[model samples]
Target: MPLSEFGDAWPGGVPVQAHGMDADPFFAGEGDLGFARQVVESAERGELFLYPGDQHYFADPTLPSYDPDAATLLLSRTPAFLGVVS
Candidate 1:
């Protein structure tokens, strides 16, 4: 896609995390995982890329697909992934 045209634009690399499910049929699709993988593969080497498995937006406590375990792991790892320490 157009992303291929912007290869030089991502000199710093990219970090992204998405709900790993097609819960929102309108917004999410099976292609998401594939796209994420493509992004990671295409990114600069030795940079950071994270995709917490099986985690989705509904992973929050009040949501329907709320997965406490997955949420916990995702939340815990996000900071380090972003290189944020406090």
Candidate 2:
């Protein structure tokens, strides 16, 4: 499929807590994303990565702990997970 993992393994009822987390700064469409982006960037020929980011999921762009840069740093190590020759 075009998108890996297909957003599975993410339990339900998480948005409730996330709902009150002030969506003002939680634009899910912006930024490189947290570990999810990192794992995606590390995709190899055959590998799967699934994770949930709702309860304590970091990378809230609006909050004081927005970590957009984490994606870039994680991208650097994706090759290893992908089994690339590097």
**CA lDDT of each candidate?**
0.53, 0.37
Q: Give the range where candidate 1 is weakest over 10 consecutive residues by summed lDDT.
A: 45-54
lDDT of 2: 0.37
Task: Residues 1-86, candidate 2: write the lDDT tens digits.
Answer: 22245554233432111111122234233432343343434443323232233322334556754445543444545766555886
Residue 61 CA error for candidate 1 (Å)? Answer: 1.3
| Per-model TM-score on C-alpha atoms | 0.58, 0.23
Residue 81, model 2: Cα distance from true site in angstroms? 0.8
TM-score winner: 1
Q: Report the C-alpha displacement of residue 22, candidate 2, in angstroms.
A: 17
What tens digits encode model 1's per-residue C-alpha lDDT throughout 30-53?
A: 455455555555656323233334
Clashes of each: 1, 1
